[model samples]
Target: MSFSITLVIIIITALISWRAFQDNDLKYKMMFYPYNVKHHKEGYRFLSYMVVHADLMHLFFNMFVLYNFGQVMEYMLDFKYGSSLGTFHYLILYIAGGLFATLWPMSKNADNPNYLSLGASGAVSSVFFAYILWNPGATLNLIILPFWDIPAWLLGIAYLAYEYFMAKKGTSNIGHDAHFGGAVFGILYVLLINFEKGQAFISYIFN
Candidate 1:
């Protein structure tokens, strides 16, 4: 059987998040607190935050997305670049997506000592977007309305628009900024790694 890095990540994240749920200190230490990241040298939170979640639902959603999209991404990468290099790129996409997702929040909330964020939403968003880029014609059903299947590219556009709007509105606790940032990173990363794929993606969407 082929090795599955996505499953490994989900297992590790689930274990850590489960333990953190019972330990406030662990959660706090692992959460993405921009204030501490700026004031103190707790830069590890940038990556560590992906391993914890505010609740079971949050963990399940992020991991579920990661599990579905991430496996697809892994297979695509391996098919394109072979096993070793593909795994490396997958790691880069996930880790860098998480790191990139924190940039805007870190800058905007650095002074707000109460600001806190957690979960693998950013990383999962990256994988989801990357999947859309490669499979633009694929049908994606809304979780709430699963019967209505939307084209992957159209869903991507709506998702980005909603995230941008929500981030600007700043009324919700959800990290819309991170979602947008991670998605952008995903698309850009895929394009950079394979410019030909970008051309194919455009043609698939338009023609």
Candidate 2:
């Protein structure tokens, strides 16, 4: 979970996305090969696609948020099982969230030729979700309303609501579906881990 490595990934993604934006013929495709749905094609695109961002702004925002949340997650994960496990878990969650994010877009726009998505927002959201699960009652300071305090879970809920609202509105360029899908997957992932270990904290929260 090196911030430098994360930054490098963002830089690479921005380059690819810029190249694609310049040349339509070179537009990057994810799990769906040739960007076609009927092909039913699947591979490591999920892991690779997270390395592509739509633009500089997109890359900046995603990586900024990721670094902000990731530092804590990386440290805790590392402390839990050394630095290697932290890296491994982070990679898995990032890839899994990206794959799930791609699924929603591909399913809804199965026949869309004008739809091409690229960003690490989904993967970042996964990190945010994981952080919340790990630090359930952590204090979250608000940026806009500086005086008000917010809980991590409430912040997540607010994010989900905003994404769902924007998705329904359908006017934003942001990938709201990806955000929702990633958040959902992240929460479920935490629950699954808890279930496997018979953790009481999860039962208290869900119950």
Candidate 3:
């Protein structure tokens, strides 16, 4: 399928979210399917939640990052892991990252019934983080700062650090906890799974 298909799917999510918010149905909360008698009958809407976004800006940024990183990762993993394993891994990380994002926040605020969030930023960040791990010395220019230059791996580290502090202090409106948790899971999961393969990568470089 073309990437535009993914874009279209995301746009549909934005429209639904907008309409739901306008209608003032509290049932429209996008993060976890809030436990309700009706939703309970449906069961496990976690995967569906990945496609939903709170607004236009939210949808754009998530799709932008996914478009940039996901296609390349998808191709590489397809070759390395075979099409089936590759697709499975991609799905695993994508869903796991979002699920973890929600879990990390909810873990601390389990009793805070008002807490709600939605977006694919945390999951896309995982893909971006993993890409950097596999391509360690690649360069990534900071678009916001423009003049800043850094190695891809280092950039990922810096992002994780910022997320850590922000999450710790409850400093901003952004979901820094999701960012940090997803990144950690990405780096650790890739390294742990490919430990032998990674050592071989190093040995080939030296030899």
Give candidates' CA RMSD values in order: 1.0, 3.7, 4.2
> What TM-score does prediction 3 earn?
0.78
Tens digit of per-residue lDDT, candidate 2, span 1-207: 445444555567677767766765555654233245445454556555676666667767888788788766767767776678766776667678777877787777766766656677888888788778777677688779888788777788889999988877878877798888888777776666544322544553577
- Best model number under lDDT: 1
Model 2 spans with C-alpha error above 4 angstroms: 1-48, 195-207
Please give the clash total of every predicted structure, in order: 0, 0, 0
Worst 10 residues of 3 by lDDT: 34-43
Q: At residue 113, give the lDDT of candidate 1.
A: 96
Residue range 54-150, candidate 3, lDDT tens digits: 6668777888788877777777777789877777777777668766666677566555545455567777787777777777657777779788777
Backbone clash pairs for candidate 1 read: none
TM-score of each: 0.97, 0.78, 0.78
Q: Which candidate number maximizes TM-score?
A: 1
CA deviation > 4 Å runs, candidate 3:
1-27, 33-48, 196-207
Q: lDDT per model, in order? A: 0.93, 0.69, 0.66
Model 1, 7-95: lDDT tens digits are: 99999999999999999999999999999998998999999999999999999999988998899899999999999999999999999
The candidate, 2 or 3, that scores higher on lDDT is 2
For model 1 the local lDDT of residue 16 reads 99
- lDDT leaderboard ranking: 1, 2, 3
